[model samples]
Target: MRAHPAVGDCLLALSLLFVDLLVLLSQARQHHGQPWYVALPLDVAMVAPVAFRRKYPQVTAYVILVLSVPHSALQLGIGSATASCVALYTMVVYVGRRQAALYVVAQLAVAVLQMWARWAPGITLIIIVLIFALCWVLGEFVGARQAYHAEVEARLHLLETERDQAGRIAVAEERGRIARELHDVVAHAVSVIVVQADGASYALRSDPAVAERAVRTISDTGRQALAELRRLLQVLRNEEVTREPRIPQPTAESLEDLAGRVRAAGVPVELSIEGEMTGLPAGVSLGVYRIVQESLTNTLKHAGPGARAQVRVRRAENLVDVEIVDDGAGKARALVPAPDLPGGNGLIGMRERAHLFGGILQAGPCPGGGWRVHATFPVRLDP
Candidate 1:
């Protein structure tokens, strides 16, 4: 009823039984040796096993082969031929080629014995062999097609799994990049604001003019920080399509601007450049800028009061180099924590930026009582 194998096999068996019944009716008219009632039961037994050929191919084929003998002995027409052929095809497709080959040999042997005993014609034997051969060929072709489809389905599933893994990896990389950007931007801006705020509070009644400049520096730094934050948030919100003006990312050339800001925040900074810092690839240039910015922020935060920082940039034919050095002396100011500690996020970010671009960064205490940060990068990156 559901169009299943058993139902289909049962239908096929019924058709074979109908053909057998017609053959028996004709034999009875001729007054054959065995009565129609006697051969009918053998025909039913032989043909019924064909219905379970697919479920139990080996057993069904052997049962059909054995029952085919008595059915043929009674001169039952077409029932042995039709049922054996169907069983052989099922054996080839479901069981295996070698077992089917043996089964076919056995079927041929039985047919030969039956014909030899009856002294049948050579043409009938040839016809029986040809029919069984056709069934084997059809089984081979269909089995090959089913195997090919199964392989294709397996390959498609593997590709889909790999594609999903790649998408997840890309997402993780994007999140890491955003986290590094936020750390660099927020850390530098907050350091400058805190320094200016402290200076403003101290100079407020001692020197109103100095205090006024420091307060103005705090306001400017906060505004700049807020602007950069909005840009980051806009990117997160996927709003780049809007017509709002966008600030260009800072690059190697912005080191002078960065130094000037630190100078304005009550520390002296000397910036020096000996290379053509232009036309750098965007990622490399940005990495350079961030490394320097983080290093300078550490200087402002950790290098005590009278500490002066010097930044030097050099460009070789195929490389760019940056170095920041500062004396730890704060001129009797409160002692602050040292810079470039092993576990500091600022130091780690700088190193990760350098490593990302196939470069190296080293930061530690100078030989002559100061802190030094140095980084080097190649001009061209691997594709």
Candidate 2:
């Protein structure tokens, strides 16, 4: 098994202490009259304090300073001085700046005492000051680097958390788009159904043939609505109806049938196409069909019965313009703009569709009488 970090640190301190003890032993052997016993205890006392240098830096530094002052004054060996430098380095790195300043002052006081006792202001005092200053400066540099790395790690974590929140917000906005698309589909289908059913009811007794034709139109319109609904639901399902022929999405051509159904429901709707609609991209084409369909739906509701509506699609080299206009003179014209009261979902959906193609939409009361919806789309999207 690998040694724990704290265990490794403790062993490193003990190793430094053993090295200082060996140096003291050697110095005592070389210098006669020093005595091995006195050197052994003093050297052990000075170096052993380093074992708790980081854990209790201020206390350990004081202990090492106290042991070394007497040992250095007596000129017993170099071991005490070496251990003092190591303890001061540990103190400055771990005990904080204010305590380090105090430790430095205390060490300088000991040095002055030694100078006065020896009566010699020489190279020894200068060497001790230089060694202590070097250790404290090195410790401060190491501490600053560690603090910088810690700050960088904190900033990176904050950025990651913000990224996660942004992703969730994007997903929520997408779900809202899908919901709006579903609403447009259902609203358009139900409007056609209700109109057709009313006509069939009125003509049921007076004109059998006319009523039968209206019922057939109703059946066809229902089937088309079901197909559109199936396409919408496929987005949520894992199993797709691959066995059936893929349903064709609405395009410029599809507007012809849409107009016919609206005309049969007692609203006179005319669809006019200009330029090259076939060359437009699928997304832009769908955009054209949906905007016209929604506008016509709003017209039938607001324009009421016997109202005439016009849908125009004009394609240019790089732009396509669509407009739907009607006269607000029908029976239900007053009730048609109910959704436009405030925060209308229909108008909101149409505007969002125009914005999806980087297009502009203008919708409001027309100069003549009824409402008008006009949108412009870029024929070719930027690469």
**Which candidate comes out best when scored by TM-score?**
1
What local lDDT score does residue 3 receive in model 2, on the 0 to 100 scale?
42
Q: What is the C-alpha RMSD of each candidate to the true structure, in Å?
A: 4.8, 5.4
Give residue 62's lDDT in candidate 1 (0 to 100).
Answer: 94
lDDT of 2 by residue, 83-131 (tens): 7787778777787888888888988888888788889767878887899
| Model 1 agreement with the true structure over 1-383: per-residue lDDT tens digits | 54586898899999999998898888788877577668889888979998888789999999999998988787787888788888888888888999999999999999999999999999999999899989999989878887898899999999999999999998788777777888988998999999998988999999999999998988888888888777777666656727577777889988888888889986798888987778888988999889888878888888887888988888887788989988864332222245445647777878888888889888877756667889998885324
Q: What is the lDDT of residue 336 in candidate 1?
A: 23
Query: Which stretches of model 2 miss by more than 4 angstroms?
Result: 1-8, 16-122, 125-148, 203-254, 264-266, 279-284, 329-343, 378-383
Q: How far is candidate 2 from the true structure (C-alpha RMSD, Å)?
A: 5.4
**Which residue pairs in model 1 clash with each other?**
305-330
Q: How many residue pairs clash in each candidate?
A: 1, 0
Lowest summed-lDDT stretch of 10 residues in model 2? Answer: 334-343
- Evaluated at residue 351, the lDDT of candidate 1 is 86
